[model samples]
Target chain A: MQIELVYVPIDAAAVLSGVKAGEDGAVTVFDGIVRNNTKGRQTRYLEYSAYEDMALDQMRALGAEAIQRFGVRNVAMVHRLGHLEVGETSILIAVASAHRGVTFDACRWLIDTLKQQVPIWKKEVFVDGAVWAPGEPFPAEIALG
Target chain B: MRLEVLFFGVLRDRFGERETLAQFPGNSVADLVRYYRVIAPELGELWSSVAVAVNQQYSRASAPLQNGDQVALLPPVSGGSFRNIHAD
Candidate 1:
């Protein structure tokens, strides 16, 4: 189980190396890079923030869940905080398993659930202006609003 | 109870304070939100849309509060919506 939240620029090769193993037949990675545009607007950069303590705990839970639900050998997740320039990797997830099917499923599930349950937030900086990226509504069960 | 209310994302920008320590006159998270809304009406209706996190977990409005509890107001999260990125 490997889960991390960092402020430094993400190194893709370094992340990939963590999951590379001789016994594992397949490794699936999800590289969440910052794009240059959003909804046709030219974006300059992005800023990510999180409630650090809780965010890390939630991420660890997600990694554990992926291991159990998908039968993956190991899971690694890293999300960068603070300012991020366009094309920089903002988040990365690497999942290793004996087969390709579970690796893909766990990798996808990790990212999707991270967006939903984790406390991290992102703000989009546009060329002309800036706005906090509109996020999906919380599930009715946990929503306070 | 003295509670520290935390703001993140747009809420931080709106409140103009990253975190504020205040005496919450009520006992639950809902009371705290209502109490602060009066003091800072500038937050307006946006106050109602935020999700509350008690000590880092997504908490319901009626969740009871204790002195020194760290309550965070969270806006919507857009982290995984990166276009041209490998999410799926």
Candidate 2:
């Protein structure tokens, strides 16, 4: 079980490492990307920041929950802080299990819970301006203002 | 009592990179914010605009405080990127 918060150049190398660790039973991975458009504006990039201390704790809890609920084996999740451009993998989550079913279930739960609970916030930088990306409890993006 | 306070992003720029001791008659989150305002007025002006977390959970200014609480003050953030994002 590994949950990390790092500031690195985004790439698939981490995913490859995850796959190598599990040795091919079953591995599930998901990458959250920066979209080109948001709220009718073109998004150039995003700035992600976190209250590192609590953000890390929340991530660890989600990983533990996945282990308990899905009975999955090894797992690795990493999220990059600072800035990122379009098409980058802002967050990566991978779950491994002896069978594919457990891996799939755990993977879904990990991402689902992350979106709902993680303390990290993403600000979408549009072509002309910017906006604060609301978080879990508030979820401003989903609600009409 | 004084607790270690961490300021991030624009907040850091406003208050500068130094931890100031915040005195509280009662060690609660409300007192912390009040001390912050007394210490840095620029920070105080921007306080309500940003979000806060106590220990670790996203909390309000009035959240309860503990003896060794690791309090972080975060400004309105522009969070993380997808994959092919730019460098800051």
Candidate 3:
């Protein structure tokens, strides 16, 4: 399992190469990119920030859980911080397994869970103004106070 | 006790990045949160939605605090794509 929060652009080819092996039949990848607009508002750019150490810890835990829960052979997840322009990949997820079904399932679950549980945040810079993108509520158990 | 307090996202913008509270009167995470709410009453409803973390772990409001503990006040994390555009 590999998990990282990086400042530079995410290299999808390099990450995919590292995860694939001869034994794996399918390698599923989820590439999340910055879009040109959000809800019809034109986006100028985006800035992502993370509670570095804590975010990494949470991401690593997600990768481990994906492996265990889906029985995938390997998992790699990376998210980029700092400035991101439209068309730039913001986050990447790769899952390798002997079969395709579990690979796809694991990849989806990883991204969904990470978005909710991880301590990373993004600010959307729109044509009109900038606002911290409203976040999904924490899972009931995690939201204590 | 002295504790390090960190804020993130919207909270960071409102309260800066981090502050050191020396001789903090709080005994638990809830107490520290209440103290912040009193000083920045303008925050109002935002305080009730924040989640607390102690030493990088998700902590309960009743979690006890000690000297040198690192506490974080986290707004709901905005990791995925944008949803509601009109939010302040």
Candidate 4:
């Protein structure tokens, strides 16, 4: 139920707290962080940008889908924008459900779907150069000509 | 009509700007591409593989565009990774 596109570092603890519910038996979190290298190149940092309005809308859709598909009670997703250093959290997803199994399944589904569908881009700055990381193509239905 | 087109990631770098206001002569996304080709040929090469978003949703090249519509050229999404605790 909480979806944000933030420039500041993601507060994973705060996001997790938002997903807490007394009735939910389990909560699963997927925390994505910035790494130090890509394909053997030493990364200096990363710059993330988004079609912000669209990205937020797409994220909201993902959270809603998780609720409908997996019967999860709450879904919290936060994605960071702007520059980030190594070891910084980039994205976080927390899913609460009545059972542990559904929580895990929903958490996985949310991140996977967000990666493919959301209009967010990241560029890796290596010591030698900076390049945009090639991403997976969108599904046929949503892809433009 | 004038359309405000946004460029992101590599596209932003290619255009050397984040957003632009374009004078669109045609109605569809393809028309916008054609217009851009005349002004910036380099962008044509990159446009072939990009996905266009209209009003914050995935849109097709054939989708009609109106004045003041917000169109964004999305290169690709390199997000959401668990490998080595980082993003791609």
Candidate 5:
């Protein structure tokens, strides 16, 4: 299991390589990249920030949970922080499993869950202006009064 | 008691990265939220939806706070790419 929040670019090839094992039959990957536009507005770039310590803790727990819940052989998740240009890789997730079915399920779950739970935020810089992308509300269990 | 309060995302934009609160009278996370609301009335509605972290852990409003504890105010997180059709 590997979970990291990096300031530099995410090496997708290296992350995939690290998760693969001889025992694994399938290695599923999800590569999330920065896009150049939002709601038809041209984006110049994006700025990502995180509550580092808490984000890492949440990520580590999710990695462990993915392995046990999906019965995957290995899981590696990495998210990049700081400035990112369009088309740059923003996040990468790899799940190795004995079969392809579980690997796909695990990979999807990892990304979806991370978006909702992880303490990371992104600001989209557009030609007109910049705004913090609205996020999904926290799950009721985590949201406090 | 002095508490180190950290802010992230939009909250950081509003409150800066961190602030030191001296002689904090609040004893719990909720009290801290209430105090913030009092000071920054413009952010009154925003406070209701935020999640609190005490010492880097997810904490409830009622969780008791200690002197010198590190508290964080987190707005909703938007980490990954927005998956709307136009986003791609």
Candidate 6:
């Protein structure tokens, strides 16, 4: 299994490769997109910036962990960067395994772990000309939720 | 030795995109935080939510610092788009 960190359109990669299901095999894919709203406000677009080194290291580590934890082989991941309009694909993950169970399990772990650990910052630029970025303000209740 | 650390996102806006030279004492991430606390007290309140990277790699805030390493300050993240199911 291999993992890649890049700044590109996530949708292109997600559908670029189609994994074939071997006899008794299965494949699982997941795609994360830019949504139209956050909390209750409308969003215009998203800008992602990365702490490249740390983000790659963490991604690689997560890939290794996924392979070891679930007997999943043949994993691919791609993340987008720069400015993206709403409803655009931002991240994509694909996995192929002999069975469906392990594949789904591995795919889930990769997505959840990446969201929590990656240094990617998604700054929501709203229609009203306001931008809400990480490492910025929000009430304690807002920050946690 | 002082390693130039670049700022990004909110940190960049708050501290500016300019690099900051911080002297290393080879301490844990916590120690570095403390050092920065003394060096740039304005950042103290925002420390907990911030993340750090050394030479382009994400590291634990508890990780020890090394000389000549390029450190970066990272904020939070969000994104995940699964493409397909188990196959091949």
Question: What's the TM-score of each model vs. the native?
Answer: 0.91, 0.71, 0.95, 0.91, 0.95, 0.77
What are the clashing pairs of model 4? A33-B86
Report the Cα lDDT for residue A94, model 2: 82
Question: Which wins on lDDT, candidate 3 or candidate 5?
Answer: 3
Best of the two (4, 5) by TM-score = 5
In candidate 3, the residue pairs with backbone N, CA or C atoms under 3 Å apart (3 or more residues apart, or in different chains) clash, namely none
Docking quality tier of model 3: medium
Model 4 per-residue lDDT tens digits across residues B1-88: 7777888878787675445566657899888766666776765546666788887778888999988998877776777754423334
User: What is candidate 5's CA lDDT for residue B47?
Assistant: 76
Model 4 misses residue A61 by how many Å? 1.1
Q: Candidate 4 local accuracy as lDDT?
A: 0.82
lDDT of the structure predicted as candidate 6: 0.65
Off by over 4 Å in 1: B17-22, B40-45, B81-88
Return whichever of 2 and 3 wins on TM-score. Answer: 3
Comparing 1 and 3 on DockQ, the stronger one: 3
Candidate 2 C-alpha lDDT tens digits along A39-125: 457888878776676778878887888889888877788888877887777888888878889888888777766765566667667
Error of 5 at A90 (Å): 0.7
Ranking the candidates on DockQ from highest down gives 3, 5, 4, 1, 6, 2
Candidate 4 or 3, higher TM-score = 3
Candidate 6 regions with alpha-carbon error over 4 angstroms: A11-24, A132-145, B18-28, B35-45, B56-64, B79-88
> By summed lDDT, which 10 consecutive residues of candidate 5 chain A come out lowest?
A132-141
- The candidates' DockQ values read 0.49, 0.20, 0.60, 0.51, 0.57, 0.27
Instruction: Give per-residue CA lDDT, model 5, range A2-66, as digits (tens).
Output: 89989899988899899998999999999999988876789899999999989999999999999
- Clashing pairs counted in every model: 0, 19, 0, 1, 0, 25
Candidate 4 Cα misplacement greater than 4 A, ranges: B18-22, B37-45, B82-88
Instruction: Report the TM-score of chain B alone for all candidates.
Output: 0.76, 0.69, 0.90, 0.75, 0.88, 0.64
lDDT of 6 by residue, B15-54 (tens): 6764756666556656655665566667665666666666
